[model samples]
Target: MHGPASSGWLLVALCAMTGTYCLTRMRGGGATEQRRAAGGEALMGFGMAAMAVPAAVFTPPSWAWSVYAALFTAAALPALWAARAGAHHLHHLVGAAAMVYMSVVMAGSPARAHGGGGSGVPLLTGALLLYFAGYVLLTGVRLVPVAAVAGRNGGGGSAGWGDRPELTRACRLSMGIAMVAMLLTL
Candidate 1:
C-alpha cells in the first residue's frame, strides 16, 4: 500500500474527473439530470479535501499552496450553495464541510510546520494524509448509497447510458488516484 503523504495528486485527479462528470451531466439539459449532477459537486469537494492532505503533507512551495487554497475556496462556495438547494442529499453538506475543513487545514499547515521544533514535515504530512484518507473513505462510501438510489429511481433508465457507469467509474477513479498519490509520497 502507498504511504499517506503522497496521495494528494490522486485526490486532484479524482476531483478533476468528478468535476468533469458533473459538468457533462449538467450540460445534458434535463432538470432532473442536472439536479443529479449536483452530486458531482460533492465528489469534487471530497476530492479537493483529499488533495489538501497531500499538499499539506508534502509541503510544496508557498505559491502552490496559495493557489490550491484559492481554488479550493472558490470551488467550495458553490458546493455549499448548491447543498442549500438540495437538502435531501446529506452528502452535499458533508462534502462541502470536508472541503471547507481542508481549506482551513491547508491554511494552518505552514504555521504548524514552522512551529514544530525541526523536521516535523513528515509527521505533519502524515497527519494530513490520514485525515484525507478518512475523509475520502467516508465520502466515497457515502456516495455508493446515493448512486444506488439514483440507479433505483431513474438513473438506470434511459439516462443510464449517460450517467450510471460514468459516475460509478469516476468514484473508483477518485479512490484509485488518492491511493496512488499516497503511495508516491513514500
Candidate 2:
C-alpha cells in the first residue's frame, strides 16, 4: 500500500480532477450537468479530507499538522457563508460546525508536541467519523431530488437541481468530508 504521505498526494490529485470536472459541468449549464458538477465539488472536498487524514492520524510534525488543520478549517468558512444563500440544508451546518470543533482540537493537540497518540486522539477520531457519516448521508439524500428532476420529461424547468439546491448540497458534502477527515486524524 502507498504510504500516508503518498496517499495524501493522491487525494490532492483527486481533488484537482473533481474540481476540474466541476468547472466543466458549470460551463455546460443544465440540470444534470449542474447536479453532477456539484457532486464533483463534493468529491473534491472528500479528497481534501482524505489528504488531511494521514497527517492528523499519524501525528506529523506540529507545523505540518497545524498547516493541514488550518487549511481545512479556513476552507470551511466560505462554504458556511455560502450556505446562507439557501443552497444548503441543516446537515451542512452541523457538518461545518463539527469540522470547526475538530479544527480547534487539532490546532491545540498535544500529540504533535509528543509525536504520538495521546489523550485527545480518540475524541478527535470519533468526532471526524460522525461528521463524515453525516456528510455522506446528507450528500446522498440531497442528490435524490436532483436525480429525480433529471429523469423528468420536457428538459424540466429553468429552475431545478441545476440551480442552487444541487450546488449547495455538493459544496456541503465536499467541505463536510474534509472536515470529518481532519477531525478523525486529530
TM-score of each: 0.46, 0.46
Candidate 1 structure quality by residue, lDDT tens digits, 1-186: 112344444556556666665655554545773545455554563545445454345555655545655655665566566666774234444444444443444455544433232222456446545655665676566666664336543545544534554465445446434543432333
Instruction: Output the lDDT of residue 53, model 1.
Output: 50
Clashing residue pairs in candidate 2 are: none
Q: Write the per-residue lDDT of candidate 2 for residues 1-186, one digit (tens) a residue.
A: 013566555555555554554554454456663454355455445535443544444544556545655555555555566566654433444444554454455457645423243425575567557757866787768766874335343564443334445655565555555445444444
How does model 2 score by TM-score? 0.46
lDDT of 1 at 145: 62
The residue pairs in collision within model 1 are 2-183, 6-181, 6-182, 7-181, 7-182, 10-177, 57-125
Q: Who wins the lDDT comparison?
A: 2
**How many clashes (backbone atoms < 3 Å, residues ≥3 apart in a chain or on different chains) does model 2 have?**
0
Evaluated at residue 26, the lDDT of candidate 2 is 59
